[model samples]
Target chain A: MLKFDEGKVLKNMEGALKLRPQINEVIDDVFSRGFSNVCWLGIGGTYASAMQAVVHMKERTELETFYENAAVFLTTGNKRVTKDTFVVISSVTGSTEEVVQAVKKCKEIGAKVLGFIDKADTELASLVDYLISYPLNEQLKFFMVGDRFMYLAGEFAEYDEFYSEMDQHFAKGIVEVEKAADEFGKEFAKKHHEDAIHYFVGAGNQWGATYSYAMCYWEEQHWIKTKSIEAHEFFHGMFEIVERDTPVTIYVTEDTQRALSERVARFIPQICGNYTIIDAKDYDVPGISEKFRGTLSPFILHAVNNRIDVHVEQINRHPMEIRRYYRQLDY
Target chain B: MLKFDEGKVLKNMEGALKLRPQINEVIDDVFSRGFSNVCWLGIGGTYASAMQAVVHMKERTELETFYENAAVFLTTGNKRVTKDTFVVISSVTGSTEEVVQAVKKCKEIGAKVLGFIDKADTELASLVDYLISYPLNEQLKFFMVGDRFMYLAGEFAEYDEFYSEMDQHFAKGIVEVEKAADEFGKEFAKKHHEDAIHYFVGAGNQWGATYSYAMCYWEEQHWIKTKSIEAHEFFHGMFEIVERDTPVTIYVTEDTQRALSERVARFIPQICGNYTIIDAKDYDVPGISEKFRGTLSPFILHAVNNRIDVHVEQINRHPMEIRRYYRQLDY
Candidate 1:
């Protein structure tokens, strides 16, 4: 893998899985306290991550869960967010103004805030009632929180077995996924890195990954213009702009909405000759259960894309860390 | 105005407002019968329309309201939707496949279905329990149903007065808005109709309009490529792709999320040399109350965009009704 450090990646995943006991403890405490509902708040990429959790929660559990944009929540202030609400938040930088302010307000409203922060001394860590600090996978942390809550509530019975498997083999599985995808990622970047723009489509739990990758990684990190559309909405209006030479990517997952993206995949080749389909079913996670593929597809797909990001940076000659206006210039 | 029939628009608006009494009656009947929650279902454009309604419902009322994509609803049935749920839907052609299927399933589940159809006879019209047939403004009809429900629930105190004012002068006020926006619309289309692509940013209630206009009209109707970003998410990752010459348009409204879009509007001029700001505050709806502007900004902003759509059609030499894929071919 180009520009990839396997040791560091494995270490991060191991550290993330190590937080399982703490996550279980926090979720058990919250369940014992008896909250009204679950509210997950974030901005940008984290918001997209929360959306994935909300989709899974809606499908598998009867819990009333809301994934709200932190900035909008700050401005509009959800009425359902009260003293009995269990608010979950995450911030890697720990200095995102909107996240900090939202956490402050959530604390003021007497809601129990559980936050995953990267540093122990960050403002967000101080504001949250329960803080889990680690440079770990945010997606795994989110699902840990959600899975534990559902397990306690009797909505998810296989939670213990699932996490036990994840704690052992998930890091090694992610590394294998990246290695398997490196060749295709390099080819994709080499062929279409300089295209006018890119179009991405995905559905089910993978929609959030598609959205975040297009905006947060391609656009923000590499300054590549891209449009991400939900597979269900792809035929509605976006298909009209596709030509024979247009570059497009479609993600197919093993979720219930697999048919939705499969529909897009079937049609894209008819109109767009330059298209790629990234199917999660193609990758084999050594020790994970087949039934849990839908639940873990987003994380697997993201690791696959990380390979593409490395190749894109190397081939396009654009460093991933450059920014024009974000935090560099004031509005 | 170029290619615009003011008389037809005025008559359509007048006809839509005429459904006030019937909408009120249906809402009253549903309320008296007592439903559990309100669910608005649609696909694509209609889904975007339902989103605007949901934003208002969340802000003003305590009623449990959900705006769901019809396709997703059919694929993954909602646990909240039951016999006591009130499902509201609309289809201009009244034969959208996913919508018809969802409505049929809802009926089978014993939930009451209220539909707005433009024709008296269609598959969807037959599926719904309560049908309102007319060629009316979907946005107006949506709000009418929502306002009536809120008024009955005591969430909206001035509902009757607001509807009375709308009946008297809303159509005429809309005509004034179009007339007022004609020159700007013409100039905007003349300058940017040939641009490689367009980027739109909007927040709060105006976000749905921005999304629908960008994808539904620009891409589907005119074959123009465009990207629409929610204003709050603008700074996160999308901003990094914007250059000095990007053709960006920001929509500013009077809603609580006004500051969100205003931030984008203020920053665009600093980054992009060629940018446009469509502020709803500049438009005056003569008969509507000043305090109701935030609630009405989406309609006002949409009407303003309609003017631009007309000019874009004329200036770009592309007919708005032409479609390359949508309904023209089998995918």
Candidate 2:
């Protein structure tokens, strides 16, 4: 629990959860008034965070949803984007340059823009047609941003029952996450303290979390060498690099594609000497149903991994806030 | 030229080119009729190869094009896939289990399945509604598969002029790739022969080739540590790992988003001690108009990297064909 603030984490998470009703209303309004398609645009970690929700919307609804890098999308105009299209863009800080430009472009196209940010006075809030601003504290930014987006997407896709369940049990879920993190964080750091390359694997909705954690936390924050591969694609090419002592982290979610991760989990231990499997089923959610657990797996796994981030930061003596180049230098 | 058979490469590439007219006819027939949307489904390298074409289609055409992993798609069924949907699937062997399952699922949904394979008698050829089979020699497979897919996608989007120019000048383009590769590959091998981790950066349509080369050739074939990051996403997180001696390869394509790659190209040398830039513009693609070169960048870059692959294979004494786990073990 080094540098961990339990009260702040709970309060920020609760603040995000409280936005559910407002987000649902906004989604309902968009749905009631017909729209052509939905586009999710963000930069870096924000884009990675929206991936699972985009996948969920694509799988569960006929609505055409695109998850794109904001800068790339601005430069390469999507033919599907039009006046009737609805775009949802997110940035923890509403002043991200690429996102600001994206919002401007969306406005020129006359598309309805929904901006998600931490402050209402920022440029994005001024440009977007609607705004959902919340406090994005460092402790809970990833989980809160991911949760809000997924909840909105689910509501738009008419998963009312699932949304209701998430609203009811997520607060309780965090308590379990805190307890589990305190235990797993120290253990993972103790075993994986050396300077080594790590491979993180997940499937289904959890793939986004796997990717985000690998890039945003491990590589960006800690300067660790890591590669995040989807479990479905693991055996194809990436697995060839695995040795008996390779460090591999497997996140097994409760989704339908759990079988895919299980397949990898079964195979890795046979060939890899150091492999850790973190299953969402190990964490207890007091009121959440088994079927609904799959939908909320990304949020839960993210919370668990966030703790690992804290441990890795402490063990390495590398403050998570330190950046060698990201915001320090001009590209 | 270290281990390359120029004549065989030319012959196989020419054979793949011969299928152009047939591919055009099929695409024309499909477009002339109608389809709900387009789905590009593949696994591993095949999936990575199709990324650029999918992006091109999404940007240029009104049709909703989806690029997805075959196994993931099979497990999480897309709501947009229906009887009217047009699904394109590819595999060199045509016997890939996941691809076969995908073809079955597409057939079950009554979708029009387009299968690209190396042989006509394969299972994928039998299951698909339409089949395009050609000789998939080691040298020509990457360029041919990518070219064929991009060509079909471009034709559907009505890029007749661009396609016509590519047809007239691609053979000449290969010759230029040969010259550049002969020069760059030897120099690269001489300096970086020792085993070390490499970072590959690419933007626009060339991102697929970058990912494919890093995973398939570098990681899988040579057991080298490599991470392929999109140029747009490089500054976001992965760039933090760069140091004075980091080995980085930047692929600068001649596309609309050339500036994105150039941005990274500009920054790397200032911060990193070792960086190699393989710009598509360096090769003189004879008879190919400047406007059309962007579309053919991936093919040219692939040919250039193919030489590097040969050099890496020679320097490391690692046969590109050797497998540690891929196809050597069952999952």
Cα distance off (Å), candidate 1, residue B45 = 0.2
Q: Show where candidate 2 strays beyond 4 Å.
A: A137-160, B137-160
True contacts kept of each: 0.67, 0.83
Worst 10 residues of 1 chain A by lDDT: A55-64
Residue-wise C-alpha lDDT for candidate 1, range A1-331, written one tens digit per residue: 5788999999989988999899989999989979988999999999998988887776677677878889988887777788999999888889999999999899889999999999889878899999999985888899889888889989889987888788888889988999999998888888878878899998888888899999999999988899999898888898999999989999998877888889999888778899999999999899999988888788789987988899989888889988888899997
- The 10-residue segment with the lowest total lDDT in model 2 chain B: B137-146
Model 2 lDDT on a 0 to 1 scale:
0.77
- TM-score of the second chain in each model? 0.97, 0.92
A129: Cα error in model 2, Å: 0.9
What TM-score would every model get versus the actual structure?
0.98, 0.94
Q: Considering only the true interface residues, what is the Cα RMSD of candidate 1 after superposition?
A: 1.2
Q: After aligning candidate 2 to the native by TM-score, how far in Å is the CA of B57 from where it should be?
A: 2.2
